[model samples]
Target: MIPLLVCDDSAMARKQLIRALPAEWPVSITQATQGEEALAAIRQGLGRVVLLDLTMPVMDGYQVLAQLRAEGLSCKVVVVSGDVQEEAMRRVQELGALGFIKKPAPAEEVRATLQRLGLLDLEPPLAPTAPRPELALKVNFRDALREVSNVAMGRAAALLAQVLGTFVRLPIPQVNIFEVSELHMALLDAQRGQRLSAVCQGFIGDAIAGEALLLFHDLEIGAIANLLGWQPQNETETSEMLLDLASILTGACLSGIAEQIDVRFSQGHPQLLGQHSAIEQLIRLNRERWKNTLAVEISYSLEGHAVHFDLLLLFTEDSLSRLTKKIYYLMEQE
Candidate 1:
């Protein structure tokens, strides 16, 4: 059997791709979590055809493609990424990727692509199958939430870009249900060994009320100030600039999310949570308040800049049932 490599930082993505492959096709599949590992596997003859994800820690797909070209490696590469931006697509094509597939790839499309590439022999397509009974409800809700979050994130990024005058790079907004204690662990990407300054703003609308926390690494202050065309000559000025930045981002993001759910939010004044504090410490201090909250984390990266921050929205436990119903209602409308 021919060997195939599926490389993605997300285990779920890799599994989805594997499942999407034609059932009748015979191949040995290998998996890698990042570009470096994927490259190493290719060099070792683990696979000739690679399905790669672009956004990964340690090494991304772009770097892998560049290195592959530099080393003159012969491999068929297909990009599978959540970043479906036009520029992202053009860059991967220029880097010699055979094709690009957006996230949440349809199984039929995957099968067709393989056949067109001569990787799978031409055969009759299989009939559609119903989703398994146990997995249907859970999968539908998660998928709907993810899709809505994607749209909202794009809106937020667009607003941020307008404010920064530079393209804002957005990763896929992650949606998950985790206890407040587990939130610190889930946010390791945002708190990667940096002292953070946070701003918390509460928003209420009908039965849905949540808090949006904007977390910025203290080291990002200068870059943010310059982006906002502010010359902070003193500590007070710096603090003001930081708060202004947080207000703009959190406002735009929360507004975008609310717009999607057909809710109007009354936002509160931004409250400064002390600077130069560990992220875990900040969360731990308020752990009791949010112990049972449902948190949605969105990490925003500014392109052409060295600024990175996270926006976290936390909903009270009692509001979850209402939130889920609203989410489902929105999904049904779509």
Candidate 2:
């Protein structure tokens, strides 16, 4: 049985990867929290495969790759980063990695990769984690972050319904916390073009609120304009209006959530963009630092006709602190 090494700074990511692996593979798996720990693991034994994430606090994956190459270590490496840029991909290939797995790679795909590498004989069906017990969540901080999205998203939808003058129905948005690379890829689907436009604003309340985002397609701009009762025009003017519309929606949506969650946050004006390669670029421009991340996907109809596709909110870690306080306050009141 080939030995397998899983290295990532995030505990959540590590658990997800473990669950995705073939259950019957006789391979003994080892863990590393960061690049230094990975080096220590290598000293312990020569593993056949090392699944690594790119970003970390003490040392990054790229640096680890450089050190390993310099020392002439030759373990088969599989990158499991959220970043899938052309340059990033090229760099990893240059660093002697065997392959890449986009974050949240389907369980089947993870199994297939191991088989192709001759690491596994058979694959097992992927099973989701069971819901945690209520008492467990009450004491756990991470679970509270997940629930924040559920409560906030519900309030945001109600606000959307009122603003659009129509009933807006939406499922409770699922929260998937990830590194910037993974978060960026999920938010910016490849099917969409390279050129992207967005509206961004900040919110401040009991806890810090990073801002909400409304990302959209240029071609779909006309559809949105029609829904809003505006005539479409040339590209320049149309682009401006789209940004404004996004700003209004994002502001109202986030504010509504804040009020319901028992937090008061002040929001800034929306910024317009003609081209943004990564959403993190926008975050950098805004000078926002977040401790946590919460993403809420929103889909609602405009006037019972055209449906607008927008992400309601993406909260940062610090902003998430506010959510935690609010939840406990509400729970105490209950």
Candidate 3:
């Protein structure tokens, strides 16, 4: 069996890839949770062909590729990542990746990609077989949710990046089950008393329900407008710019997550929650409606621009049971 390394920060993501591989392919699989480990394994001949995730801690797949190329290491690499932006795909190809596959990679797509890369021989399925039990267990709920949100955010970031003509820096998603107090404190501390603006929109479908908040730093609005080659000459134009950004980000992000779980969220109209307002006031306004919440936070930045945005997917307390049920089957089945 050939040695294959699956490197990803999320255990759920790693297993999904493992299960998606051509069932009859001849390979002894090893796993790495971060890029440094992946590099060490590759150097030790543990990964002749690698399936690598782009977003990870300590090091990323892109860094690993650069290191390998710098040292003149020879190995076939296929990037399996959630960042499907044209820029991301182009960069990895230039960095020596054999091919690219988007997240929740389907079995058929995996087969075709591998075949095209000459990594898999054309063969027929002999029988329906189960993946190893170790790879089939239910992953930790928090990690699973973060993985889902990670993939979801990648799509959103790609879209936003395309519109703005900038590369979006994706942070590791933060997942929390927070009491109302904890939520307030968390947001306040993260904001550091900076003046901010936000767009609030609610969504629901089937048993899943949540609200998405897109928070923008007040001072960065002008910089963002400049990126689009426009200068806001009046209050209305400035507000229009902010609203347009909020709409694209909020809609694309919510749609990404909804697509992952096979649910269609009917999103309510977005409203300006506040303009040049303190986050504390925003939290106070929201406190009455939140008791316990599932908060998934993603911080996005641009590669060479002074622009940042925080997107929060806040699932209400009542939505917990149904959301958990949805996530339970999501990772297990994938």
Candidate 4:
């Protein structure tokens, strides 16, 4: 039997890829959570076909592909990522990926790719089996939230791109419900080893209220200002530039989400939490103030620029009941 490997930081993504495989394909599957592990597994002759994800900690899929090329390893690689920007696709292909599949891939697309690669024989498609009702509902709800986040993020990205006069690359927004204390863990990539500058804006409406935070690495401020066509000569000028950028992004994102959920938000003024502060310490100060929260994290990177930042929307636990209802209603409308 041929060995096939799935490499992604997300367990959910790996499971989806497994489920998407042809039922009769004669292959043993292996999983790796990062690029280094995936490389090691491939070197050990563990996989002839690899499913890869692009964004990961420690090492990313691009680095893995570079290493594979350098070692003259021959393996069929298909990139599976939520970073669907054209540049990303072209980069992976240049690095020798056999093909690209965007994230939240439909099972049919996966099967088609395998068949096209001559890895799977063309066979009649399997009859769809109905999922358990509860499981189906859960999946629908999650997908709905993701869809909403995707739309809102695009709207925000568009505005930012317009302001900076550059294309903005957006990752798939990550949505989760967790205790307030666990918030810091979810932001490991964004806050890793960087003193962050953050701004917070609160919004409230009938039965729903939340906060939106914009986080930037302190070192990136100068590049960000230059991108915005500003030359800040003083600390105050730099601070103002940061606040302006944060306001534009946060307002557009929050407003877009609010419009979709059919709620009008009364937004508060944006407040700088502190400059050069640890993300954990900033959140810890408010730890007792919040319980569980539904967090939507969006990371934006500028194409051809060194500026990258994170936008985190935090909805309070009490607001989730209404938020879920709104999402369900939006799903129905779709």
Task: Compute the lDDT for candidate 2.
Answer: 0.61
Query: Which should have the higher TM-score, number 2 or number 3?
Result: 3
* Best-to-worst TM-score order: 3, 4, 1, 2
lDDT per residue for candidate 4 within 172-217, as digits (tens), equals 6788887865886776567777878888888899788888888988
lDDT of each: 0.74, 0.61, 0.86, 0.78
| Alpha carbon lDDT at 269, candidate 2 | 70
Give the per-residue lDDT of model 1 (tens digit) for 77-156: 88887665566778899999988887656788887777677766533444544432212222355556655555566556
Q: Where does candidate 3 clash, by residue pair?
A: none
Query: Can you tell me which runs of candidate 4 are displaced by over 4 Å?
Result: 122-209, 216-222, 229-306, 320-334
Give the TM-score of each candidate: 0.60, 0.49, 0.94, 0.62
What TM-score does candidate 2 get on C-alpha atoms? 0.49
- lDDT tens per residue, model 3, 43-87: 999998999999999999899999999988878999999887889
Q: Give Cα distance to truth, residue 276, candidate 1, Å.
A: 3.0
Write the candidate numbers in order of decreasing lDDT. 3, 4, 1, 2
Instruction: Pick the TM-score winner.
Output: 3
- List the RMSD of every prediction in angstroms: 6.8, 14.5, 2.1, 6.8
The count of residue-pair clashes in candidate 1 stands at: 0
